[model samples]
Structure formats: C-alpha cells, structure tokens
Target: MVIVSVVGGISLLLLVFLWSIKRGQKTVRAFVFLSAVADGNSVESANELAKRIDLFAASELQKKAMIMVEMVFGGSQLKLISHARREGFDQ
Candidate 1:
C-alpha cells in the first residue's frame, strides 16, 4: 500500500510539471506572435494582435512582452497606447 501511494504521488507531481511546461510553451508562442506583429509597424495590426493575446490565460509572459514591445517601439507610451491599448492584456 505504501508503495502504491508513493507511486501515485509521484505521478501526480509529474502531471503537474508537464502542465506547467505546456503553459510556458503557450506564453513563448504568444511572445513570438507579439514580436512578429510589432515588426510590422502598424497600429491597426498591433491592436488586432492585442485582441488575440487577450484570449490567452494570464501569465508573466504578458509583462515581459509589454517591456519588449516598449523597447521595440522606442519606449514611447503614446505609441504603445495608440497601437495597443493596455486594457485587458494577455500580452
């Protein structure tokens, strides 16, 4: 019985770890998508991208993406806001 319980616990932990890795992959994909959109230099495109990002589950990747976006766009708040509203961000 003890061995069975131990194995069950380890299996649960393994499942949780795999789930976390999957979530991280999603975040990375979103970040890459954001980079591609930002490179286009179109506010409309960015806004559309923002809409897509909103569909993602909340995560730290969103904050990192914002920082990267600001740097890419020359750190201008006006430009960022104009292109992508910070409201309801997932990126």
Candidate 2:
C-alpha cells in the first residue's frame, strides 16, 4: 500500500511539472503581446492567461512541444529587435 501511494504521488507531481512548463510558455507569449500595449502587463493577468492556455492544451506532449516552440522560435521577436540594434551583419 505504501509503495503504491508513493508511486501515485510521484506521478501526479510529474504531471503537474509538465503542465506548469506549458503554462509558463503561454505566460511568456502573452507578456510579449502585453508589452506592446502602452501600459505594462500585470503579473496577475499573466498568470490568468497561463491558466487559460494550460486548460486549452490538448495533451501533455503537445503542451511540452508548444512550450519548446515558443522558447526557440515564437519569442524571437525581441531577440531580432536587439540584434538589429548592432552594426552591419558581417561574418
């Protein structure tokens, strides 16, 4: 009984961890858009946005993939802007 309970608890925790990562990526994307607004984005609003996105995620793997995509590609708007600030792009 003890071993079974321990395994169940660990499994639940793992699920939560994956969900949080997916939710965090949604927060980042929302923040990027909110930053475009004249007023600054609030932490509360960002958290709410994350919750909505988490609920909308189709599956654990899909959620994880979305987060990875946002990090590597979707969030490059700022990186490109910063790179453009520098001098000519020559190798």
Candidate 3:
C-alpha cells in the first residue's frame, strides 16, 4: 500500500510539472506573437503556435499588447523599406 501511494504521488507531481511547462510556454509564445505582430510580419506560424498554446492573459491586455507590438513592427518595416528604396535595392 505504501509503495502504491508513493507511486501515485510521484505521478501527480510529474503531471503538475508538465502542466506548468505547457502554461509557461504559452506565455512565451504569446509574447513572441505580439512581437511579430508589431513588426507586421506575416507570422502565420507564430500566430498559430501562440494560439495553439493555452495562456491566461486577459483578452484586453493581450489585444493591446499585440496592437502595440504590431505598430512597432510596422514602423520598423517602413523605415527599412524606405532605406532600401533610397539605396536602390527595391524588391
């Protein structure tokens, strides 16, 4: 009986640890997605990955952060494009 209880406890602990890792990865994915959005890159993969991972961020905060990141990304993209165009490397 004691041996069985020990095994069950270890199993439960392992499950909890796995869950935490999944949750943490979700948060990291969201942050990465936000960055991609900010730059306005076609981040289909990152977006899908972030969506696949489950996170606990409030919808409002997530949306705002995404928008903010998107704006930053868009700004940088424009600057680079302008610079490239001026340098005669338009593509």
Q: Best-fitting candidate, measured by TM-score? A: 3
Model 3 per-residue lDDT tens digits across residues 1-91: 9999999999999999988655444434555555555566555654654555444543324555445436654633334334323433212
Off by over 4 Å in 1: 41-91
Ten contiguous residues minimizing lDDT sum, candidate 2: 82-91
Name the candidate that leads on lDDT. 1
lDDT of 1 by residue, 1-91 (tens): 9999999999999999988665444444445444555586354555455445432533546577557546766754344443433432244
lDDT of 2 by residue, 5-38 (tens): 9999999999999887655544444433333221
Please say which candidate is ahead in TM-score: 2 or 3. Answer: 3
Q: Scored by Cα lDDT, where does model 3 land?
A: 0.51
Please, what is the whole-model Cα lDDT of each candidate in the order they appear? Answer: 0.53, 0.46, 0.51
**What TM-score does prediction 2 earn?**
0.38
- TM-score for each candidate, following the candidate numbering: 0.46, 0.38, 0.47
Point out the higher-scoring one by TM-score: 1 or 2. 1
Any runs in candidate 3 off by more than 4 Å, and if so which?
Answer: 43-91
Please give the lDDT score at residue 53 for candidate 2. 42
Identify the runs in model 2 with alpha carbons over 4 angstroms from their true place.
37-91
